[model samples]
Target: MKAFWTLSASGELWQHLAISSWRALVGFAIGGSIGLILGLISGLSRWGERLLDTSIQMLRNVPHLALIPLVILWFGIDETAKIFLVSLGTLFPIYINTWHGDTQY
Candidate 1:
């Protein structure tokens, strides 16, 4: 499994991790914003909640990780693809947390 990816630069592991972290941070910001907007809507408005709540729940329930292959195919194993996947992973948690917080208020 590990052999699939090549770590070409022997001492570039730190740099690689840094790049991955930067991508994840970018993804987090984008995904978190979308999630917050969604969570706020779901928590604050009945119409908005009804419109998104089900779909969000449904999609979130699906193994988001399952989309990686499609993502890689669509975006090609680039920074965009990595960020997109990370963003997708970040979305639900932020949405869920915000929704919970909103409801608790």
Candidate 2:
């Protein structure tokens, strides 16, 4: 408990926290925007849905863990890789929810 408290009180903790928060927010924004746009298109146009829905659903089902090696190879173990993984994690749920919401009404 003492060590944990000491670590929490340190400047390094805050810096790490801020970086994590920034990554999360930026990733969410990118993923959410793309999901929303694609969802809207899919919901509004039958052709768009036919073209994209299957591909997206198929990609969504592929496990994130399975892609980590590829992501690392492509982006390396850097901030970009972290953010890309975060965004990819967020994209499917946002897309499915937005598509359902747009289409149900």
Candidate 3:
């Protein structure tokens, strides 16, 4: 529709996208840092892997969309909850990929 196209091209749309992109970038960084630390710890200590591997795998399979209601219930509709979800979403992918990539053949 013309109205949808006009709205999509508006300055407000770009601003909203930029804000969302920035949050994604921040989430990526936070998650990547956590993943990297976990990777290093796993590499450096078998005990760390023993402690963390199962829980990370369990968390990986959780449906993120389904978490919104619970996250909002637990954390409320605030910046902290939004960022927490973003961080969790970002963290899982990196951790799963790293674990898969680095594991033995």
Best by TM-score: 2
Model 2 TM-score? 0.93
Consecutive 10-residue window with the lowest summed lDDT within model 1: 1-10
Give RMSD to native, each candidate.
Answer: 3.9, 1.2, 2.5
Q: What's the candidate order when arranged by decreasing lDDT? A: 2, 1, 3
lDDT of 1 by residue, 52-96 (tens): 999999989878678878887899988898888788888999999
Candidate 3 residue 48 C-alpha distance from true site, Å: 0.8
Which of candidates 1 and 3 is the stronger one according to TM-score? 1
What TM-score should be assigned to candidate 1? Answer: 0.82
Point out the higher-scoring one by TM-score: 1 or 2. Answer: 2
lDDT of 3 by residue, 1-105 (tens): 886678687857777778788878887788888987776565456787898888887878889998899999999987668777888877876776666666643
Candidate 2's C-alpha lDDT? 0.91
| Predicted candidate 2 versus true structure: per-residue lDDT over 1-105, tens digit per residue | 886678687856787789999999999999888888888889888898999999999999999999999999999999999999889988888899988988898
Model 1 misses residue 7 by how many Å? 9.6
Q: Give the alpha-carbon lDDT of every model.
A: 0.87, 0.91, 0.77
